[model samples]
Target chain A: MAGNVIEINNLTKRYGKHRGVEGVSFTVKEGDIFGFLGPNGAGKSTTIRSMLGFLGYEGEIKILGSDARSGHEKLMKNIGYMPSEAMFYPSMKVSEVIKLAADVRGTDCADEAGKLCERLKVDTSRSINELSLGNRKKVSIVCAMQHKPALFVFDEPTSGLDPLMQNTFFELIEEYVKQGTTCLLSTHVLSEVKNYCKNVAIMKEGKLISCGSVDELTHTNSKRVIVTADGKKSDYLYKGDMNSLIADLSGKNITQLDITDPSIEEIFMGYYEA
Target chain B: MITLFKHEFKQNLKSLLIWSISVGTLGLMCVLLYQSMTEDMQALSDSFSNMGAFSDAFGMSTLGIGTLKGYFATEVGAVHGIGSGMFAAIMATSLLSKEEDGHTGEFLYSLPVSITKVVAVKIAACITGLILFSVITGIFYISGVAYLGENFETDLFLKYMISVLLMNIEIACICVAFSAFVKKNMIGAGLGIALLFYFSDLICRISPDLKDYIVYGPYSLANATEIFVGNEIAASAYIISAVLIIAAVVTAFVKYTRKDLAS
Candidate 1:
C-alpha cells in the first residue's frame, strides 16, 4: 500500500567481526512519525545507512514499497537525509549548498528555499565553516528539506539546535506529516522523540527489541498513580508502605489525577528490564 | 556526475592559473638569462666547459636546449609537468576524501549518483584541468621562443611538449589510483606512491634490461625526445604503462565503490 512508507525484514549488516545491524525489522506507516531509539553504537546509524543505500546490508529494506537497494534511485530523490554529523562543503555558503542539492535533486524551488530559510531561521549567506555547530545543522536541515522529499530520515536531527530552534523544527516536521510525508527520526535522545513520534522502534545491540505505537509502550510498560486519600500532601502515599499500597491498588484508578505518562526512555529501558 | 565534474574542473582551473603564472614566469626568466649569457663567444665556450658535468646530469645540453622542446622538457617540464602532475594526483586523492573528511559522505552517498560515476567524473574533470594546464604551458613555450629569437630551436618543441604531457597523465593516473584505494585524505599516500614510481624509473635507467621498467615511473613516457633524437621509442614501454594505468583505474573504482564510508 502507498500507506506503508518504509518496511524492513530481518536486515543484517556485517563489518568484518562486528555486525553493523542484525535482524533489524520495522515498518513506518505513511505519514507516520517513527522514532528509532537506541544508545550510541547500537546500530541506529547503521540501520539508517542501509535504508538510504549508503552501505550494503543483508536484509530486505523497502522504502515507499520499493526495494531500497535495487530501486534506490527513485527513493533517493524522495528521501531527505540529515546525518548525525552536519556535513556540507566548507567552501560553500549555506544557500549555495542548498542550491547545489536543489540542482542534483532537479527541484526548481529557489523561491521556496528563501521561505524555508525564513522558517528555519537559518542565514543562508554564511559560509559553512563560519557557522556555529547548531547553525551548520540548520544549514544541513535546510539542504535536506529544501526539495520537500516525501520521507525525512533524520539521524540525531536536533542534536545541535537551541531549544527555540528545536521547537520550530518539530512544528515544521508536524507540518510535513500533515502533507502525508513519512518521517524516520533516529536518535538516542528518547525524550525528544516522545512528544512527536506516533510509532516507536527500540533498538538494542543491532536488533529491534520492541516496536509499537508510543501510546502502547507508555500504557503497557509504566504508569503513574493518582492518590486522593486526603486534601493534605502528607495524607498521600510517599514511600515504604505507600509503594505496597499502590501495588495493592494496581490497575485501578483509585483517585482523580493525571497519571504520569512514560516517556520513550522509560519504555526503552523497560524493553530490557521487562 | 556532470555537476560534480564541473565543480572539480572549476577548482582545478583556479589552481592551474596560479601554477601557469608562477612557473611560466620563472621558466621564461631562466630562458631570458640563457639568451644574454650565451651571446659572448668566449663566455659561450667557458659556459659549455663549466656546465658540461651539470648539463649531462640534468639531460640538458645533450637534450639540445637551443630547441623549444628541450627548453620545455628541462625547464617547464621540471616545473609544470612533474610538479603539476603530482598536484593533479593529489587533487584526485583529495577529491573524494574531502567529502568523507568534511563528513559529507552520508549526504553525498545518499544522492542518486553511484560511487563509480562520482570517481569517474572527478578523474575526467582533473584530466581536463591537466589538459588545460598543458595548453597554457604550450602557449608559454611559444611565447618564450618568440622572446629568445634566433636562439630558439623549434624542431624538438612539439615533441617534448607531447612527451611531457603523457608523463603528466601517467603520474596523475598513478596517484589517482593510490588515492582511491585508501580511505580518508590520501594526498600523502598519493605523493608517496608517485615518488616511489618516479624514483624506480630513475633507478631502472642504471640497467639497459631495466629500461623497460622505467615506463612504470612518471617520467618514462615516449615523447619528442626519442622520436626527434633518433633514440629507440620503446614501444613495449608505452604499451605496458598504458595497461598499468587502465588496471589502476579499474582497481580504484572497484575498491572505492566497495568500501564503506566508515569515517
Candidate 2:
C-alpha cells in the first residue's frame, strides 16, 4: 500500500461554546477515494476548512507530508479544493474568474480549463451572477480540476449538479484517481461513498464513530433475514455464519426465504442511533 | 500577490469612478459658488458673523470669506474632507469584509497564497482606489478655480491636496482594521468611525480646551485652510496620523491572518 496522503490527528475546532469538530482523526492513502460521511452540521465542512488552514483548530493535520498550518501555502499548491458553496465575484465573467485562479496558482491551465468547460457544458462568456446554481457548480468543478492537482478535497461536490452531470463528474474523478490522484469526498449522501469510495469514515455530532471498508462495515453489522412459512411472516437479525443460520432455520419448514445484506444507509443509520 | 492585487483593483474600479465623479461635481459647484459669493464678500462675512453660534458650530468663526483660499477652504474643503473620508472608509471596509459577506472567502483562501499576502494586496488595492479618487477630485477643483479666473497659490493647493489624501488613507486604514473585528456590520462600523471622528473634531473646534485631546482626528491633520495659507502647520498632526495608520494596518494584518474564517 502507498503512504497516507492526508493524516489528521485529534483535530478539534470550537466556536466559543459551540462544538465544531472534536477529536476527529482520519487518514487518506494515496490513490484512494476516501469518503467523509456525516449529516448536516456534523462538522464535515469544519474539518475540511481546518485541513485547508482556513480556520484555527487544535491537534495536527499533515497534507503531502507537511503541516497544514505552517506549510499551507506550499501544500496548497498541490491541492484542488472545491468548497460546498460555489461563489465568485459577481461582476466578473466566468472566463475572468478562471483566469484569475490560474494566474494566482502561477500555472497555464488554459487548455485543461477549456476542455473541462466543454465537457461540463459550462458557458464561460456570461458573468458569474447570470449563471444558474448548477452552472456555477460546473464552473467551480472546472476551476478545481483544471490545474490537475495531486490531491482533491471536494465538499459536497455534486450537490447542485444534475443527475447526468453527477455521473459525468464521478467518471472524471474515477479517471483522475486512476492516475494516482487522491480524493477526499465529504457528503451526507451514502450511495456515492458506497459506489465510489474504497474506504469510509462516518462522523456524527463532530466525532468520528467508525472507519473501515464497505464490506467490513456491512459484515460486522447484523444482516436482515426474512422467512415466510405456513402463512406467517417473520424477520430476523442474523449475526452468525451462514451455515449456522441455515441450521437454526432448517426446522422452521420455510415456504419462502430471503437473506439480504444491509445497505450503507442502514449501517450509517445504525451508527447514528448508537 | 500581483494577481490578487490586480483582481481587487478591477473589482473596485466602478465604485472608485463613482466616488471620483461625485466629489468632482460637488467641488465644481463649490468653486462656481465662490465667484458669486466673492461679489458680496463683506455682506456675506458680516452676515456669517451675525449668525453667532450657528456659524461657530460649523467652524466659520475664524474663516475669512473674502479670500478665495479661505472660501475654498471653509466650503469646498470641508465637503471634500468629510466626503472623501467617508468614501474611503466605506471602500476599505467593504473591500476587506465583502469576501466573507459574499461567501467568496472560501474560494480565495483556498488558493496557493498566504493570508498575509492576501491582506497586503487588498490594502494596496484600496490605497490605489483612494489615490485615484483624490486625484480626480483635485483635478476638477483646480480646473474649476482656473475657469473662474481666480489667483491661487498652486504649491499651497498641492500641499493641501496631499494632506487630504493622507487623511483619507489614514481613515481607510482605521476602517480596514475594524473590518477584522466585525463579521456583518462592516459598512455600519466604518460609517460610525468616520462620523465619530468628524464630530469629535467639531466638538474640539467648539471647545478650546478639547483641541489638545482630539488632535488625532483626520480633520485636525488635514485642515485645508491651515495647510492652504501656509499658516502654522501641525507637524504633530501628520505624525499622529501616520502612527495611527501604521498601528491600524499592523493590527489588521495580524487579526486577519489568524482569524477563523468560517465563511
Candidate 3:
C-alpha cells in the first residue's frame, strides 16, 4: 500500500504478569492518516512507545524501512512524537524549549516555529511553569509540528485543548497531510477518527479486534432501522438488503420509516458482544 | 551533544551558582575566623590535642591547628569535602531522574540523539558545574590566606583540590548509576547515596580496623589532612575510585538505553 511508512508485527510488551500490548500488528501507508482507536488501557500508548523505541517489545517494528530498535536515532530524525501529557523544563521559556528541540534535531525551524506559535496563540516569553495545561499542550504541538517531519506520531494529542484549538490543530494536521506526511493519531475519540482518518484499527483488551476503512467498518456492520407501522413500535437490527426490509414493511400499513448508520459506540459494543 | 550540553548547563546554572556561593562564603568565613585565633593558636592546639576522641570524631586530630594550612584543612576543607560530595551526588542523580519524574522523557528521548550521547552530555555538564564551584571556592580560599599574611602552597593546594574533585566525580557517577534503576523517588535516591558515603567516611574515621574495608568510599579517597600534608595516598584508593566511576558510568549507559520509560 504505497510503501508502508510503519510496519508492526506481533509486537508484545508486558510488565510482569500484566500485558501492555500482545500480538498487535498494523501498517500505516505513506500519506495516510491512520487512527489507532481504543479506550483507556487498551494498549495504544504501549504500541506507540514501542514503535518509538521507548519500550522493549518482543516482536518486530520497522519505521521507514529501518528497524525501530536498532536504528532508532537515525529513524528519529524524520519522526515527530507528541505525548498525551506535555511537559518541559519548568525553568525554561517556551521559546527556549522549542529551540532546544530544533537544536536536538540539528535543523533550524525558527520560521516554522514562530508561525506555529502565532497560529497556536502561544506566548513564547512565558516560562513553562507559568503556563496552563492547555497552553502547555499548545507548546507541545508547536514543537511536534515545527520540524515538519516525514512521520508524526501523536498519542491523544487533543485531550487538554479547547474546541477552537482542537479545530486549529486538525487544520494544521490536514495541511501537513496534504504535503504527504504520514500520521498515526492514537485516541479514544471516535468523532476525531471519523472526521479525519481514512483507515482505523479498533483495539480492545490489548488486542486488535477490527481493522478497515471507516466507511467499510460502519457500513459492513449491522444497521439500526426503526419502523412505525399503525402505531406498533419495534426496533430492528437489519443485516440484509435495504429493499428486502422495505418490501417486508410496505404491506404492513407503514406510517413512517427511518434508517441510519450506527454510532461508533454501538459498533464497538457489537464487536464486544460478538 | 553540544546542544544538549548547553541546554543542560543552562538548566543547572542556578543550582550551581547557589552551591558555589555558599561554599565560597563558608570557606572565606572559616579563614577569617582562623585569623582571629592566630594569636591563641598554641592554646587552641593544646585543647584540641587533649580532646582526643572529640577531635578524632570530627577528623580534627590529625592536623595541627596552629598552622594556616592545618587550620584550613581541619575546619574549612572538611566541610567543603563533604558538602561538595553531597552536592555532586544530588546533582547527578536528579539530572537523569528528573526527565522521567517530570514526564519530559517522551520529549527528549524521542529526539535524534542516542541515549549514550544524552548521558555523556549530562555527565559533562555536571562536571562543569563542579569545576566552577571548585574554582570559585578556591579563589575565596586563596584570597583569605593571602589577606591573613600566610604562605599559600600552590602545589599542595592544587593536589588537595584535585583529590576533592575526583572524590566528587566518583560520588556523582555512583549516583548517576543508581538513578538509572530507581526511576521515581529521585529525592530519596539522592539522599540515600549522600548518607551512604558520609556514614561510610565516618565509620572509617572512628575506627582504624574498618579503614581497609571501607577504603572504597569516596570520602577516603581524598582525605583533607592526608592530601594537605603531602602524605602519599595509597594507589589502591585511586584505582578503586576509578573502577567505581567506570563501573557506574557503564551501568548507566546499559540500563538507560534499555529502560522502559514510563513517560
Candidate 4:
C-alpha cells in the first residue's frame, strides 16, 4: 500500500472573529493527485497555508512523516509551493530569479531550469516587471517544477494560464506523478479534478464537506433526467433510487425519456446544496 | 544567510550610494567653503560667540569658527549628523517592512530559512549599509581637507567620525525595531525620529537644566562641539547607547519571529 505523504488532522485557524479553517482534516497518499476543491471564500487557501506552516493553527500536521511546524525548513527542501499570486523582485530577470532561488537552497538547478524554461517558453532575459500576468505565471511554473521536488503544492495554479499552457502544465504534472510525486491541487475547476485527480476533498464555509475518491464523491448516484410527457419537455438533475424516479414518471404519458450521468460540476454543486 | 544578505545589500546599493554621495558632497562643500570665508569668518567669530543661547546651541560659543577645526565642527558636523541619522533611519525603517509591503515576503519566507535567520540577515545588511555610508562620506571629507592643505587634528577628527557612525547605528537599531511592528514603510517616522533627537539635543545644550538628561539621547555621544574641543564624552552616554542598541535589536528579533507576515 502507498504511504500517506500529507496527513492533516483537526486543523483550526482563526483570524480573531473571522474563521480561517475549522476542523479541516485530509490525507494525500504518495503519488496521488489530491484535489482540494472550494469556492472563493471556502478556506482552501487557509488550509494550504496552514499545512505549509505559513500561518499558526491548532492541530497536528505531518508532511512526509514529520511535524509540519517543527520540520518546516527541512520539509521545504522537498516541497515546491506555488502561491495563488506569483510575486518576485521586480528588478530581477526571470533567469536571475530562478538562479537565486536555487542558490538559496544550495543546489545547482541550472540544467533542469534551462530545460523547464525552454519547455515553458519563458523569456529569460526580460525583467519580472516587464512580463505580463500569463508570462509571469509561466516563470512561476518553471520555478516550481525545475527543482523536481517530491511533493508539489499549487494554489489556483491555472487561474492566469492560457488553455494551451494549462495543458502543458498537466502534462508535466502527469510525468512527475508517474515518477511517484504527490500533489495537492487547490482549485475550483471541477473538470480538472475529475480528469487529473484520483482523490478529492471539497471545502465549504471553512469546513470539509466531502472527501473521498473522485469516483465516490461525484458518484452520488445522481443523474440528469430529460423527459417529454404529454407533449411537454422537462430536464432536471435527479438523485436517489432509480426505481423511485421511474415509478413517478410511469403514471404520466412519457413520450421520450433520457437518463445520463451528471457532470462533476453538477455533483459538486449538489454537495454545496446538500 | 549570506545569500539573503547579498541580495538585500544589492537591492539597497542604489539608495546607499545616492544618500552617501549627497551627504558627502554637502560636507565637502562646507569643508571647501572654509577656505574662501577665512577673513569673513574671523570677523564673525567674536560676534557669533557673544550671541548667548543661539551660539551655545550650535557650539559656536565653545568653538571659534575662524579656524578649520572649529568651522568643520560647527558646519560639517551639523550636516553629517542630520544626514547620517536620516539615512540610517530611512534604510532600517523600510528594511523588513518592504518585504511584506511589496508582497515579496511570501516568496522569501517560503524558502528553507527561518524567520529569525531572515531578520538577522536583514539587520546585518542594514549595519553594513551604515558602515559603507560612513566610509564613503569619510573619504569625501578627508579628500576635501587635503585639497585645502589645512592642518587638522587627526585624533579629534577620527574620534568625531567614529562617534557619528555609532550614533547612526544606534538610530538604525531603534528604527529596525519600529519596522518590525509596522506593515508599511515608515520612512517619515524614521526621519521624524532623527529630527526629534537632534532638536532634543539642541534644546538640552541651550538649557542648563536639561544638560544632564542629554546622556539619554544618541546625540550626546557625538556632539561635534564636545569632540572637536577635546571634551570628554560622559561614560553614561556610551553605556546608554549600548543598552538601547541591544534592547532594540532583541525586541525586533523577537517580535518579527512571532508576528504573522502579511502574505
Highest TM-score scorer:
4
Evaluated at residue B180, the lDDT of candidate 4 is 94
Record all residue pairs in model 4 with backbone atoms less than 3 Å apart, i.e. clashing.
none
Interface RMSD values for all candidates:
1.5, 0.7, 0.8, 1.1
Clashes of each: 1, 0, 0, 0
Residue A183 of model 3, lDDT score:
94
Docking category of candidate 4: medium
- Model 2: docking quality category: high
Q: A156-230 in candidate 4: lDDT tens per residue?
A: 899889998899889989999899889999999988998899999999999999999998887667789999988
Share of the reference A-B contacts seen in candidate 4: 0.45
lDDT of 4 at A259: 97
Q: CA lDDT of A154 in candidate 3? A: 95
Candidate 1 overall lDDT versus native: 0.72
Q: What are the Cα lDDT values of the candidates?
A: 0.72, 0.86, 0.86, 0.90
Q: Candidate 2 at residue A243, lDDT?
A: 88
Looking at model 1, residue A259 earns an lDDT score of 47
Which ten residues in a row are the worst by lDDT in model 2 chain B? Answer: B52-61
Stretches > 4 Å off in candidate 3: A225-257, A272-274, B53-60
Local accuracy of candidate 1 as per-residue lDDT tens digits, A162-226: 99999988898888889878899998777876889988888888888888998776665245445
- Candidate 2 lDDT tens digits, B60-104: 556667778878887888888888988898988876678888889
Worst 10 residues of 4 chain A by lDDT: A137-146
Residue A230 C-alpha lDDT in model 3: 80
